[model samples]
Target: MLRTIRRAAFDQARTQLLSPLSLLAALAMPCVFAFVLHSFAPGRTTPDMAVGIAGIGMLNAVIVDLLGAMSKEKVWRTLYPALGSPGGLVPVVLGRLAGIAAQALVSLPGTLLVLVLAWGISPDFDWFRWLAGGLLLAIATTAVVGLLAYFLLRFPSSPGMTNGLTGILIALSALLVPNAALPAVVQPIAWLIPQSHVMAWTRGGDIPQILIALGQVVVFSAVVLASLRRLERIAREQSVPLEY
Candidate 1:
């Protein structure tokens, strides 16, 4: 399994290396984020800002690297045949992982560099801890985004609508607004989003609290992956020859 995943990763990296749009999309988000966040909303550049920006950076990276490419694959009829190969699901999924990883790698550091050096903010680097927390956050968001990608791939009638809806979800799920400031009606809903906890942790919340949030993100990812299992099976079953 590890060898399969490793090969999938290498293949994906090679594909992305040639994808100019992937690199452009990855570059655009964080640069725009740093400018906008630091310029207009400097007051909001607290720990939460770090986390929120990082979260979006990570997500956008993942989407550009994985979901966006996956859409192209579906459109070009490359995905289903790949899935039909032996030990296929793992490779397909891992290939997605391999492809989009650059997004996370590039976006996170660039955003943080802007935050710490340019913006003069720091949330204690601690590489091991940061990676642990980041891995959890990244994986969780991937699950949600991947499930969304599946549905969109299955039904591309309105890809624009799908992307728009997802963008809206990412904005709200960001939890940028202070918990106290949230409307009473939406408070429960806001609290329920996995990204909410991720936002909290990003803001340099209490260590214990951050761990709890990590726990929630992990649990939520598991829930999302579990929920998608049946859908994946059914989608594959009902799917026909790949679209061109």
Candidate 2:
């Protein structure tokens, strides 16, 4: 089962890179936001600015690879038949997730390289302390959000609607802005989204905050998986398919 999923994951990465939508989105959104936000930021370029761009990149990771891919399948009604088969959901989920993982595998190292070569920023990647936590959070964020996008896909029956919802989620994440700047009610709402927390942690902003973020990821993951399980059971009963 794991092997099948891993194989699907491999195919997913190859196909994702070939996707024109994914390639353009992966690069363009981050660069454009990076330039615009950096322009408005008080300093010529602040750490927050860099973090925001990187966060957009991560959100793009979810958008292009997982949410986008899932919607693409369902938009064509390709996913439902696959979901109906045995050993099918495993590969489908893993393959979609594998594509999303490819985004991070591309971005995180790329960000570090750009910082070192182009920006002349230095980070202690080899440090006994930094490597473990950094790698862990990066993986954790990707895994949790990939799963969330899968569940969200279940809610959107059409590709366009699913894609649009993801874009809106990214915007409201508020990694580009501050919580206090938002209306009081919205601040708590923003904090509820993992993208907001993932962006904060990716920028090397706060550990305690990210720990809380990881907690949210774990909680949401459990809920999404459990819900998916229920949906699958309902589908098996052939009882008019409510979760869809």
Candidate 3:
């Protein structure tokens, strides 16, 4: 299992890196957003803000790029063999997403560099905290994206749905705004979002909040594994292909 996962991760990372256009866009979008925010909301821009933006960029890679790759695999009929592989598709999916998540880490420094050079913003960046918290957030995001792949890959209109979902998640992520600033009713729903808790931790929240975020990651990971099992079972029993 470990070998399979490692091989898949290597392959996925290589493939993504080789795609220069996609790779450029993935790294550039966060910097663009950071510049725009710094230009307009100068007062709100801080080191924590840069970290939060970077975190959201990592998620954009996981959710958008990962799903886009899955869709391509389905179209090219490349996913069928993985589904039948000895280790099954779960590890392959997780590994590929892990690769993508790791690649997304580049956006961290990319965003910070833009802030420093473009805006003369010298943020007191905490490297240890950002790397550690960003990694945890990426893992949780990978699990959530893997689960989303199960449903989104089956539809013809997945691209539109993917964009819509990404926008919604970002709006509620609380990376740009405080949770307390959100409406009382929406606060509960935002708390349930893994990114919200993870962002809180990244921004120097207390220990309990980080624990809750890690707990959510574990739960989401378990749910993803179980869903993959069900997906495989249904595919075998009903002759249902991964895509419609």
Candidate 4:
């Protein structure tokens, strides 16, 4: 299982990160989005928050890659064969989840570097806080990615359906602006999104809030696993096979 996870992560990095064309396609839009986010922020004191908001765009890029990978598996008729493997589908799906997280982790440094150099944004926190925040962000991103992957895979015909939800999530995250600043109608929705608290932790939120963010990740992960199992059962009942 460990080997599978490693191989999956490696393959994801190679295909998406190492491939010149894929890198260009994947990074282009995110870079543009990041620039726009920086323009909105335009604040020197809260550089960390601004950078975090920009970095969120990169997370979206990773999500798109994972969605594309899943779409290819189904379109190319490889999902069934993958599920039928000796290790079963759980490890494969878990590996994909891990791979997606790993890909995001790997890209974070470069993302930060770009924000620092290009946007002149520097996190005002200490090294220890930065490290802890990075760890939390990775876990948070994994949970969010898993949930979105479940939706995309479950409703393969409407892959773009998750985009609207993701946009709402980003807006509700309060990365670019404080939740208090949000419009009255949207303010309540911000409380429901984990980022309301999660981002706070990275920006010096209390211990309790950080723990809540961690708890959210755990709950989201379990939901993702349960959804995967349900999908597997449906595939079995349908007797889906990879017909070449």
Q: Tell me the whole-model lDDT of each prediction, alpha carbons only.
A: 0.58, 0.57, 0.71, 0.62
Candidate that beats the other on TM-score, 1 or 2, i.e. the better one: 1
- Tens digit per residue, CA lDDT, model 2, 160-234: 544565456555666577655667877788787665665565455577767777787778667655656655665
After TM-score superposition, the amount by which residue 28's alpha carbon in candidate 3 deviates from its true location, in angstroms, is 3.0
The digit string of per-residue lDDT tens for model 3 on 116-234 reads 66656545667666777766766766766677866754455433676666566765777667788788988898888687887787778877887888888788788888887787788
Model 4 local distance difference test score: 0.62
- For model 4, give the 10-residue run with minimal summed lDDT: 43-52
Give per-residue CA lDDT, model 4, range 1-244, as digits (tens): 6777676666666666664443543355446666776676664334345335434654665566677666665676756666777654566567766766666554456555665667564445355555566556666766766776665666645636556654666677766566777899998777665666666765666888777877878887888888877777776787644332
- Candidates 1 and 4: which is better by TM-score? 4
Question: What TM-score would you give candidate 3 relative to the actual structure?
Answer: 0.88
TM-score of each: 0.74, 0.71, 0.88, 0.80
lDDT (0-100) at residue 64 of candidate 3? 62
As for candidate 2, its clashing pairs are none
**Reference-based lDDT, residue 23, model 3:** 59
TM-score of 1: 0.74
> How many residue pairs clash in model 4?
0
Off by over 4 Å in 1: 17-20, 39-47, 122-135, 157-159, 218-220, 223-232, 235-244
Q: How many Å off is the CA of 37 in candidate 1?
A: 3.5
Model 4 C-alpha RMSD vs. true structure (Å) is: 3.3
Off by over 4 Å in 2: 42-47, 71-91, 109-159, 163-167, 199-206, 239-244
Give stretches of model 3 more than 4 Å off.
43-45, 121-124, 156-158
What is the descending TM-score order? Answer: 3, 4, 1, 2
Pitting candidate 1 against candidate 3, the one with the higher lDDT is 3
Best by TM-score: 3
Cα lDDT for residue 158, candidate 2: 52
